[model samples]
Target: MTTVPRSLDEIIASADALADRFEAYEPADADRDSVDPTTALWLAASRRAAAERDLAAAVVEARRAGVPWKVVGELVGTSGEAARQRYGRHAAR
Candidate 1:
């Protein structure tokens, strides 16, 4: 699989910049209709994808640290079998 072109630090900086912009935003009445539905959906979907990747990576780290799958499942809000099925391959040696 391909990796992100940006370094982790650069990616974090970009996220921080986005957060700053969002915090500074003050929408006008006219701006209410400015958001495109497709863009909004794409943004949410993209963020969800990123979150999933982060979760998977964390699972790998936890497994490497000798954390049990049962605990991982609880933390991820699922059963041990479910968590194993989902992220076990990534954590496999």
Candidate 2:
């Protein structure tokens, strides 16, 4: 079996940068209907941000699925107690 690569903060940062770049470089005529390229880029960046959120949620779910807090925290660059305080509430419901 292969383990999937998961880096929530990195993914989120990348997505935000992409979105910011797309917005910054958008053409002046990139209104709701003028040119389609900017619109497409905007959509793609939005999708990336959404995907990042989904992945973070999945990581949280994986923790809820009985994966150890220490391991999850290590993967996310935090301590087990930190992970518990930050994410344990999700598993409460």
Assess each prediction's global lDDT (C-alpha) against the native: 0.93, 0.76
Q: Write the per-residue lDDT of candidate 2 for residues 1-93, one digit (tens) a residue.
A: 844436998778778987999988855554645658887899899999997677568667877688898887887789978877877776465
What is the C-alpha local distance difference test score of candidate 2?
0.76
Native-to-model Cα distance after best TM-score fit, residue 47 in candidate 2, in Å: 9.3
Please identify model 2 stretches exceeding 4 Å from their true place: 1-56
Candidate that scores best on TM-score? 1
| C-alpha-based local distance difference test score of model 1 | 0.93
| Residue 28 Cα positional deviation in candidate 1, in Å, after optimal superposition | 5.7
